[model samples]
Target: MRLIRGMAGAVLLAGTGLAVHPAHAQQPGFHRHDVLQHDLSVPGREVVQVRVDFDPGAVSVKHSHPGEEIAYVLEGTLEYEIEGKPPVTLQAGQGLFIPAGANHVARNVGKGKASELATYVVRKGRPIFVVAD
Candidate 1:
């Protein structure tokens, strides 16, 4: 629990402006579990954010990260793919980091819903660098 709180504080200090309430801190709700969260905003530098969600089949598009990303599989499985590497299968309680300029994608590869959390430290105004080519 202390680790989760520390992570949450780091996220808040790294943001430009985010409206979060203590009442909703670390609780499971609709769409996401939100075990913790942090915004990524650095003045004249980079932006960093962390998101924790609880659900199955939640996914993002195939894209690249302009900066670096660290993702932790808190409670479920996820199918992860990078542009030039063999796809990776992440199970519950696992985590991986994607380096800057690396193209990748992720999806819930499990049969049912899965929950996971991700923290990204990225260049400001640029997050996912998706190319259709």
Candidate 2:
């Protein structure tokens, strides 16, 4: 199981290009809603679930998670890039996993809005996300 916290920031690039920027980049047409959160049986561990929605052309700035992240696409297409890896296109019913502390970005490459369900398993008392430098 995974969990999420709060809004940190996002980087909005024009397309598939990768450009580093400050955390306060232009706002993208993206939204995140908390689905569930609870403490794990393991001490100092927690799980969070969230639904992320992206309008066409929306892009998230480079960032890292406090723990492991797993995402499943529900609608449209998404271009997901992790540091040192090629961008992968995920469509409906597809899923991906990201390890803790790996910089990554996500964009809505399809013509319409895209949505995904993300789960996080992280240490308690830590922010769910951190903006990468």
Clash number for every model? 4, 8
Query: Which tens-of-lDDT digit does each residue in 1-133 have in candidate 2?
Result: 1211122353331221122222443355976665778889999988888788898998886788789999999999999999999999999999999999999999999999999998889888776667676
For candidate 1, give the lDDT of residue 60.
Answer: 50
Best prediction by TM-score: 2
Q: Pairs clashing in candidate 2? A: 2-47, 2-48, 2-120, 2-121, 3-47, 3-48, 3-120, 11-61
Total backbone clashes of candidate 1, pairs 3 or more residues apart or in separate chains: 4
> Which prediction has the highest lDDT against the true structure?
2
Q: What is candidate 1's lDDT per residue for 31-122, written digit by digit as tens?
A: 33333334435564444444544345655544455677788886667878877889899898888888887767677767777666666566
Error of 1 at 108 (Å): 0.8
